[model samples]
Target chain A: MSQDSQPRKNSRFHLTVFALIAMLTAVLSVGTPAPAQAEDGTFKLGLVTFLSGGAAGPFGVPARNAAELVIEAINKGTLPAPYNSIGIAGQAIEPIIIDEAGGGTKQVGEYRNLIQRKNVDAVIGYISSGDCMAIAPVVEELETLTVFFDCGTPRIFEDNKYKYLFRTGPTSTMDNVAAARYVLDINPDLKSVSGINQNYSFGKDSWADFKGSIQTLKPSVEFKTEQFPKIYAGQYGAEVSSLMLEKAEVIHSSFWGGDMEGLVLQGAARGLFDDFTGVFTCGETGMFRLADQIAEGTILGARGPFGVYAPKSPLNDWLRKNFMARYGTPPTYPAYKMAQALMGLKAAADKAAATAGKKPTQDEIIAAFTGLEFEGPGGTVKMALGNGHQAVQDMYYGQYSNKNGKPTMTNVKRYPADCVNPPDGVTSTEWIKNGLKQASCK
Target chain B: MLKTDNTSRNLCIAFVLLLLVGLILPNWLAFLTTIALAKAMVVVGLVMLMRAGLVSFGQGLYYCLGGYTVGIAGQHLGITDAVGILFVSAFIAGCLAALLGLLLCRYREIFFAMLTLAFSMILYGVLVKTSELGSTDGFNVAKVTLLGWQPSPGQLSLVVYSLACLVAFLTAFFMHRYYQSGMGFAGEAVRENEIRVEYLGVSPQRVVFIKYVLAAMLAAVGGSITAMIAGHVDPEMAYWTTSGEFVFVALLGGTGHVVAAFIGAFLFEVIRTIAFDLAPYTWQMILGTTLLLVIFFLPKGLWSLLKAKKVGGNNV
Candidate 1:
């Protein structure tokens, strides 16, 4: 009995030892500190974007590429005009890239990890409206300076107030409102209008705002039909069939990423575009991939003055040339949005440093960001709404025409920021419902 | 009786050990562990259904229900008490399960799985359409209070970690006993031969209904704690892919023991984090290859390694 018990005791002891070793290794491995900051006190920025998943093609990849190129340009002082600097306030920029392919809940955890574990000074990224909304409150709670680059939801600032959060891009209302104004500008006799958008906040809000604007702009336009398909739904056979049945004069859609590509391809195969003129609010992002398939006169809008509608300038030319050279394709709307965000950050940081006479804290940066205006690749981006926390910018929409082998926006009409964005102290919904009566269109 | 006593003693010791680890682990590790334990609770619940030869492809429905309940309670009703939110959410999920289980217990195999998937998708659709609930963005969950104490952001994370460790251990203990009980054996018996179980005067449908409700309640508890710790909830919680992950963890751990679920969840999270850090673009490929290798070598699961050693006379 003693001999049998001795073997059992030895095995139990071995098991305990093994468990202890495993726990110790796990703790030690995770406890490893982040890499040391570079010489000259680098400004550590956590850049979050979708590195994988459906959104990667149009939004995430371009945003991440722009971040990489812009940071390199700032560090090398190769950028032109207002952005020509050694770094943000003379500090080298170091970026830690994190994938945003995970859902909003996972993104919250990743946001915390980026701040607590990675020790980033600032965070700049988020393409999904869901991710932007989720991280907004957390960044406010943590008091971490963050810049949302391309999420267009108007609800982020409208729903809740955040001091440390700033969005350097136009809200969804700007895109839809501009699209409506363009339709009215070109087609004065527009009779019937229809829409198809992803069945989510970004899509739903875009459609509502567009409808509201069109009603305010041209009350005679009668509604035809509308469809709200689920986001990332690869097939649009049923939706296309329904739209064809309506036979409306104008069909507006706000699809993006792989969903947009799939919609354009599937719709083209069925000749949906041939039956009616289609206005794609986010079509510019997918033009590179769908240039051959897209119909000649299909209307297209970049969420803002992006891609082909971007204003010509030395700074814009330099950015376009460098981006095309490195990426082997011209920068899309998402890239321009990211560049605008980074440039806004640099300008804010420079102002803060100048005011404080040293490297500024998150609070100082927030102060400088409020009511800030700076030159973007497109035009000037102004923090005109949400108490100067949200950005308002010029927008453009036009018909898609094949230029040589590439698709480009033609007959482009630019709308100033004041013409599309809601005035201060007015929610987008309220503003739209009120017929945008106060909006000043040049 | 002596064996039961030993099992309880071991559970207590394990609980104490986990509590100590929760206290000492760094914030990030603690956060990761809390998430793993919360996810493990759902996987263990999935294992309960798996033992009855029922594979739910839509456990995410209950998970999201629980998460959204907590979020809504905290955001709207101002119910910030951790325990209060957890209990309320679990009760809501239980009531929903009781109603759904009556209809679900009649089906089996792929039909049952598809029904579960359909229900979850319905919830997703509703959530996406409800603009007041932030639509697809969902909403943020306010910070929670423990009893009457309000912890700082840092302390709240640690407190939540400790609570998760305690809750997970208690859940595992009860589930272990449930697995050994007569009803638990009846689940397997029915799975093996429903006709034999019926002849033995046991109602297989009744057993499955009870098991379904129990699994739903457990999953809800898991979802509530996860929402609290993450401080957010969204429609993705109800998405089919999220349900698929719970099933993957269940299969990876095996239905051998309740403890296997926790182990599997921890290892899965650790492997995923490492893979994400090492290869951001192809992390899914790495996870897929690992799962394939594990399934090839250990058909029963990673848990079988311990059982195999015990059968070979190295019992510990």
Candidate 2:
């Protein structure tokens, strides 16, 4: 308040302004990209997944583990026959792994950083449908080869086409469609059905596809109560109680990770699983982790022929052996999906490079990847949908049964990719509503 | 008059320097800078309330509203003009704030904070359930033309980055003037003692309401720009955590000067980016620890560290 302090306050105010400018300059200077890392005979790939948050343990970490295992194998030429070549296109593999815990907006920024800053040759990541949708357009804009390992929303392709984007896993539509078909084949006496899925795109799409397929498959089936609790709502006491009250003959959920574990635990405790035929479209994620808690007769799928239901193949054998040896847990569906994506990329790159007799250009890689078919640990994966940009693989379903002390799946069935997935150029919604007339089943 | 001129000249010089910086930034840094500036705009509005001793925990209501407005406009109504969308976003947010401000302005302190948060959460809940808008995943935002001049995909980042800097400059320039104006002084008086403000024939309630609505409009502008740059909008934007971030930046920068909001936001983003790269699993812990250190060492904020000396040892 005194004149002497007045001048000092004025000087301090200016000093504060100067300090702010200096700090900003310092930060921006750090962001100024260093000369892009020289291409040191290695393919720098960005692998993104939920490294933290609720999805980390069950989904993201497994996917990350698979990437590390698969990339190392690819780099060392240790994978099976078709993928025995070292690294991608003869270049040693280098991965820049990033966590995809933040929401879509943050993912968008991170995706740009991966491509523009890290200079990744290709990006394989995104388990959240929201993040996938957000990054898809940016992928095209950046014109970098990026593969979405697992995000079940069909809208990504059905909404817009991307030249640089490829999803190496079947959409949630197949998981639901396969579930409906498997349940009907196992139990033709199905009557009323209900669902309790997370209130998000993946959950909503799964339930819709399942319901539509069920209606088309058996018009006599009655619809019952449906509960969509918020995503990651760890406590499902109220939702379980509602499902119990409905007393629907069949219960379906596409919940994954902690949400799936919580729902199964709470529902089993309340005897809902005992009374209802519980079907988890993405249950393969919990097959081993929640083995003791899951009751018998619960039909579950690995989204495709993955994990316990993976078709007998050399690739599957290699992945299972190596993943189990490294992580102490069997590779789940997320792990399978990650392996499939990396293999698909490597296969395409190898093909392109072989034809060119050198490192392939991005366009050459795209040409080889589009509509290409390759064998994965799960089964033969065909880029048969989304104009050959999206993978359509055979789906497997089985009953959860505990034998002795270990949990396992029984009565496993495989639905051919074409039989379960919509044919190219057809949306899953339209394909299901029209009774899957174009479907070719043997 | 001389002091005001000096401040205006300094703002202009700073603005030009930022514009120059935007031009040279790489694509990734441009995107990050765009996001930080967009968030800084929202913090500017929060600082306005902070000056009046009112903390709004739900500024995200307007922020999300602005984002959805622009998204809906582009995806639904076919409006893609960047400038036009910004105005429409601000107007829509202002209208909503005007209606809500009537009831919200009456409350003070924690009640005011919680009420704002409740409104934002309500928007988040509604957006999550609206299947037409893509539900919880929300939907993508299309690229826009700048005054009918469309930039190529490669050039869009720089264009939007420059625009963000420009907008921030204008917001800071006007807000600095407002801070020195009668109404601005009235806000401080209300914070210091409401009775004195009322004794001066200024209705404290009316002043608070005006500040509330203006703050909402500012937040909406921030949200709209973010949606444009990120090309995506979701219910998460309205979630309490997003609002908490704006508050965190406000406290970090201090309400000492208009530029503090931006300085704080930039530092927060930089720290987060580095921490994430260094310790991907424990970045949140690093962020929390940084805030703790800031509050402990410089209670007034990072801005106070620049001050010549500590007087009276007042922490808040």
Candidate 3:
């Protein structure tokens, strides 16, 4: 090559490389905010939920929809009763929605991004128990006020104490306790009970809690079989056969999301539900999608008094009406949990502002949230456990029945929070084993 | 003399550029880059295996082992020092690879791939059932310390980022040299014709076993750093999809150059973040389309673009 040509080519290559670097730097700068600017009086909130993947269908999508509708209602000052205000403490709510489909580690990084890069004043969302556990410490380390909406693992608070993190819904133990109670209350001749749960923390803990509660409630109720299938295992042929072989009079499952739907479909196809009265702890989330497949007389629990079992009140009526009108279906348990979390945040923020005469800081908001009581769609949610870091709420369970070709719960029984939830300082296992003597059921 | 001088100068230039990035980039970008670079270490290991005509569909087994080692060491064993945890994790991963390599080197192609995948799935199953380690909920990794000095939360990110840069540069430098070594060439020879390598008085299986062990160590480093940065570890690290991602990045960057893995991981992260932001509902579709386009236009991978330009070729 000629010398002059070589120099010209080198210059062109240098220009191209420089341009590429400049372009990448510019693109990256888009995700990074330009430092913390003066607050514009808007309450920036980061709302995370699964937007894609298996969990999104039953849990994440409904939660996202509820956040959208509720935020819009709050900003417009159209919510009924205590929530009838323009945003929290008169500040407009600006939400930045993030997908939580990624694993726990990714969720931790996203949580940091929400606080450090996006400058969200408060953050709420996590349906995966793993994500909640992973994020709890990081939230405390970052000193960011955060609320875990629907992850049911009790270990988040049981294992570690967090100053700025709270779960706005009851733990998984409550659902299991109420499920066992409902079964024993109705089935006087109940003898053998079998269980099929996803082989995960939530499922294992729930099964253990249910078995402990049942063993305490009836000593002669023989345990037949227990199967822990992998989470999101799309088929249940073998699991169904095992349940049939065991001849369990009642089968208990804490499956949720697509896994629950898959089990219902496959079990019904095999006539597994015919001989066994299946009791599902998280059946409400999939009821709308699996209406036809859910056999009549199959018991269902909402994890709380949510969806069809929601209390009769104007606030709940408005939530149900607005959510149904927008999403073309009534809000389910996941949506109710999301709504409850946001409503609790609103109450805390409003009270803190009123007390301080200004928008409260993260610590101030957390202080107000501790022992905070608010009326949720499901009824009253009290931060009555975990040193007020955890919520204890009443739960409902009922049998599924087809009413006018749509699935609805019949003979629903609402168990008081004090009846199901373990008392302060007592683990669910210990409480159940001790026959719940310390529990206040009134 | 000139070739050695050029290598030194390039290394200096790259180090300076990374230092500048660490200084200038925002915290979130720095965090993302650190993670991508850490993950690139594993992709580089995959590329090494690919050079030997071996594809591990279960590299996550080593990766997850590394992460869980760091976690369990810190949480249960009271080993909170970053360097100590990383060392223990790498040692554990290397030992496992050494034992597994004996049997694994006996197979090739699909059998090797399936065996690796099966191993990772076994780890996943074990982790899912082990409730003491938080079961599927997984456990949080405690804050890391350097020697006896513990950085506060604000300073932790910067410290981790700097460490990631230093580790990545050193690994890449050694890897570049290893590519031209006798054992490295023997790997390619075994890949091309195992009988010919055996006839050359070099045991092909031995070379493969050494490469497998080395890859496991590199992947462990990647996993350890990732756990430190994220401050959490779960069975998902050992899931088949995570290993698939490593393979994707390795192929995306090509096994031609050592630096390609870093570039590929960086580009992947940037593309994925932007896609998720722009189309949260269809980000996976966008990612798939990008991969398809890359395969259609630049089948040799993204690194081939730089190589083709350097050679002034019309390969595209």
Candidate 4:
């Protein structure tokens, strides 16, 4: 090798090494945030949701949009009464949004980063049940005030007690229980029922609860055929064929997102919905997008009294109008749930400050938030279960109809909070097994 | 000869520096470093497989086995000692690998990759169906005791980080020495030409089988350390995407050196954390771009930048 060539090669090698080191240093510094101090005066709220994943389009993005819209409104003091305050406890809300595309392990790391590095005053976002269950214990360990916005798993609070964690949205129990009651309400002499739900926790738990509740309500009713296709399995050709063949009176499902849409298209094309009464416990999100496609007379729900079934109030009107103007789409149930979580957080902070006559600490907020009754765009939400850490609200189900080329809900039925949700001391499974004896419907 | 000595001395220095760094790292950085190092263990073993011309896409099988072993042992046998749990994790994963390696060694290339993936998916299916273990949600692991010394919640992360540093050092040291052995060279030869290796009186299948089992144990140990740090184990650990991530890390560092895995894994984690923070909506795109740049420019991986070329030949 020539002397000049050798020198050039050596310089190149050194330059490359320097570049790698510089890149690594830059990356490391990105992780090291400014030291935690409350003197900044701005409340840093970490918002986590599915920003980029299969769940993003229908569930996560709407929740994120709702959070942005609500936080913006609160910062401007333009919200309806009781929520027309400039941020939580007189501080401007500065959000640090994070994508919840990764699984539990990655989420735990991000959750720590939010608390230890960003020093977020509180966190409020999660749509996946797995992510919720995983982050609950971490929230307590770190002692950071967190509000789970949209995950519907009941196991989060029932399985363990948390000091710093609260789920503003009602659990999945209310969805299925209300669906069962609505099934009985619509047809008092319901004969046979079957279901097709995803095979994971949300789907399995929903199916079990629905089946158990229906059986308890009417012992003579028969279960014909149940199909549990894997979660996110878009095609349901075989399952649809089986359900059609069974000739059951009612076909219940807990499908959501793309899978739900897929089933509506496939099942509708196959005339499965026409042959049976379809009850979808989590179907309200698809009402607008699949308006023309959804079969007429199909029973739909919004997880709780959300979306189309939400009570008309000033808060609801503001959310609908502002959200439509901002995003060109009406907010769905997930959006309503996210708005509810932020409202709940603001209420707790205000209450805690009122009691202390100053800025409330984390413990003060926790104390004030427990068993708090707050008004959301979806009407009243009460933290009445899981020792006041879990929210319980009324659930609504309605029949879908295609009237004059527009989708509309007909025969809307509502189940009060106490009538569907299990009592505080009883697990949903145990409550269902006991024939829902404590249910008090007016 | 001089290059080998220099590499060995550099490994020692790096290991010591890593431990010292762990002692002073802030909690969040320490958590990131610990997870990166633990995953590096799996990548290091994967480097050995790459050297032997075999790529197992289902390394998650052992990774999941390791995590599940720690969880199951703690729940059923009441074993909270970190040392005992790690051993059980390694032992169970090694035994399963040994049994699977017999049939896996008979295949090559895509067949080998697919069969490994099949086994991993089967495990994922089983774990997902098992509701007692929390199914897709997974159960949290109890805080482990260190030889009967329980750490307070405040000190637990530090202790776990320290433990990870020591284990990582031992793993790298052992693999460094192994690479200098004849069997290690035989692995490379098997990759080059299995027929030629046979003529040299070494059975290619045996070398591959032994390496597969060792690799499985290493990956399991990595998985066990991660479970302890995260304090939770779910079926996602065994998902095919996770195994793909292992492969991605292996390539990011290359198979040139054992320490390359550590450097590569650290860079991967740092890049991901920063990218996710910077672009919440399109972080995956950033990661994809980084991988593309690495493949185009430093085809041998980021490790190649540190390796000085000899006057007459390439640096090993």
lDDT of each: 0.86, 0.88, 0.86, 0.88
lDDT of 1 by residue, B247-308 (tens): 88887878888888998888787777666656777889988897897688656677876665
TM-score, cand. 1 vs. native: 0.93
* Residue A171, model 4, lDDT: 93
Cα lDDT tens digits, model 4, A323-384, are 99999998999999999999999999999989999888889999999999999999999999
Off by over 4 Å in 4: A1-9, B1-4, B309-316
TM-scores of the models, in the order given: 0.93, 0.95, 0.94, 0.97
Q: Best DockQ goes to which candidate?
A: 4
- For each of the candidates, the C-alpha root-mean-square deviation to the true structure, in angstroms, is 3.4, 3.2, 3.1, 2.2
DockQ, every prediction: 0.40, 0.48, 0.48, 0.59
| Candidate 4 structure quality by residue, lDDT tens digits, B1-316 | 4345766787778778877887778788888998998899898888898899999888898888888888887776788888888888889988999999999989888998899999999999998888888888888878788999999877888888888888898888778888988998988998999999999999999999999999999999999888888888899999999999989888888888898899889888888888878899889998889888878877888777665445513522
Candidate 2: what lDDT?
Answer: 0.88
Q: What's each prediction's clash count?
A: 0, 0, 0, 0
Model 1 alpha-carbon drift over 4 Å, by segment: A1-27, A34-40, A269-271, A403-408, B1-4, B148-150, B309-316
Docking class of 3: acceptable
Off by over 4 Å in 3: A1-23, A34-38, A403-407, B1-5, B16-25, B313-316
* Top-TM-score structure, candidate number: 4
